[model samples]
Target: MQKVRVLIVDDSALVRKVLTTMLESDPGIEVVGTAADPLIARDKIKLLNPDVLTLDVEMPRMDGLTFLDNLMRLRPMPVVMVSTLTERGADVTLRALELGAVDFFTKPPADLANTFMDHAPEICAKVRLAAGAKPRERAAVSKLDVAPRLSADAVLPLAQTPGTRGGTRIIAIGASTGGTEAIRVVLEAMPPTAPPIVITQHIPAAFSGPFAARMDSCSAMRVMEARDGQPIQAGHAYIAPGSQHLLVMWDGAKHVCRLHDGPPVNRHKPAVDVLFRSMVASVGAATIGVLLTGMGDDGARGLGELKEIGAPTLVQDEASSVVWGMPGAAWKAGAANEMLPLDAIAARLLALAHTPVSAAASRVGT
Candidate 1:
């Protein structure tokens, strides 16, 4: 593989030096240049044309968000934001992702100055994954601002109500990499009347709550980060808190969300496999499994398990995925029954949830 050339952009001279040293430590990465601001970064972008850019949110003359907006519209390259781990910082980072950033990492803990080396592996990993991402113009996603929001009744007007007694069906979804926007696209098109949906997207804890809020603002379904012990309800979607694992368990007759502070599975705290495997015990047979765009094979085995006992499984096709590693892994493992684009996933899920089932009905007719 060729070396991944990187350009470091931050107003702080110290941060730029630290980041360049950290990124270049790996033999696969080459620090092409560094810039103190987006203005200088603009010139470097044209000159060095680095494979990846690490941008800081706060800057002089031009802020990171505005610069990112301009970059995606004109050049549309892969970007990763380096931000502070604060509420205000999370807000801007989410906006950066909306503008087309591939991923992010927080400033290393002040107490870890001696051990700040912990951040290097993750930073390099994100940059490597980003180098291969399929970034689109922001104009397409900006149109989502005007998409008509359908009420619960508008989603599946002809289907029977989803949540009732012990019969509440669950829709389980998992994604990573470019999932923030992918999840938003699917949820925005869904009606509130759709079955209860649980999501596990790979996101930082500081950003998860804001990501949910942003999802809710654009989506018809009420979206919120999952709280431990919250009862699963129709017309709402629960995102796994980034710091913990979100699992499902039968709270009497109703399936409810359970957050765990367990060790990381598949190298992720709120891993897709953890949530997908949990669904097998809590909502067996009455589940619709969706594995979306992501890198790595975190969800593959768990999704295969879901397929074993008869649940319909869907994957976002490679043409629409940012990485296709997760969905492609699951498909190769015989986990996916349908491979659809991002736009079609919501409708297919609704169809499976609404179709009447008999004792003999095993597979979804569609």
Candidate 2:
């Protein structure tokens, strides 16, 4: 594979030097150029045509957000934003995602002497994902594929009432790469009475809160970051905090969120595997596992575990996925029972979730 060519754009000379070095240190990535601000970056972008760009969210003459808006509007390409780890910075970085930026890496504290080196692996992964991500127009981002619509009848027979047959139903979802937007669309499409959802998205610590708040705004159900030991509830979605791995724990009859500080799985702290494995042990047949677009195969083996124990698993089809790595791997692993587009998965979940527990269990073996 060709090294992903990168151009570093930052106002701070030290940042430019450090970021360029950090990215180039990886054999898979090559630093093509460095610029102090968007102006120099613009000229270099045309000249060098780097495959990926790491841009500071705050820049000198032209604000980073403004430059991003123009860049996407004119020439669509994969770009990753470098943001400060603050509330304000988090919100702006979320905006950059909506503006077609592939992903972002938050800057460590000013006191952290080796910020780039400390987080070098994660930064390089983000750049690699960005370089391979599909570029779309700012105002006309591609809509998710919703082919072969599914209905409630597909999962639950109309002759039976789902309310009478089921125990507590829960939806557990995981995503990375293009997750933020994909998650928003899924949540927005959800009805008011959908089952409780626990999500593990690959995000940095500072951005998780803001990302949840952003999802809450666009979604009908309340969405927030998972707090340790918080009980999972219906009509709400809990997001795994960036630094912790989220798990579903059964406390007596109810399910709750559990956070772990273990080493990263598949190089992701809030790994999809952790959540899926937890649900397999905790929720059993009532768990609906949905794996969306992501860059790596973090969720494949875990989803396979879920499938092993008679749990339903769905993966976002490649026609709709931004990278198709996670879902594709899961499908190849015989983990995914249904491969649906982003728009169709929600309907399938709602349909299957409404099925009575007894009936759901019977179908689980399929």
Highest TM-score model number: 1
Local distance difference test, per candidate? 0.81, 0.82
Instruction: List ranges where model 1 is wrong by over 4 Å.
Output: 111-113, 139-165, 357-361, 364-366
Q: List where candidate 2 sits over 4 angstroms from the true fold.
A: 111-113, 139-166, 358-366
Candidate 2 per-residue lDDT over residues 1-366, each given as its tens digit: 799999999998888877877777678888989999999999999999999988899989999999999999988889988899899999999898888888888877774446456777677778988887886566311222223423222221222211211257888898998888888879998877889999999998989999999999998898999998898888999999998988888777577889888767776778888887777667776778889998878888778776666667899998787778899999998888899989888889999887775676577556
Which pairs clash inside model 2? 166-357
TM per candidate? 0.89, 0.87
How far off is model 1, as Cα RMSD?
A: 9.5
- lDDT for 65 in candidate 2 is 91
Given candidate 2, what's the lDDT at residue 282? 75
Ten-residue region with minimum lDDT total, candidate 2: 156-165
Q: Whole-model lDDT, candidate 1?
A: 0.81
What C-alpha lDDT does candidate 2 achieve relative to the native structure?
Answer: 0.82
Task: Provide the clashing-pair count of each candidate structure.
Answer: 0, 1
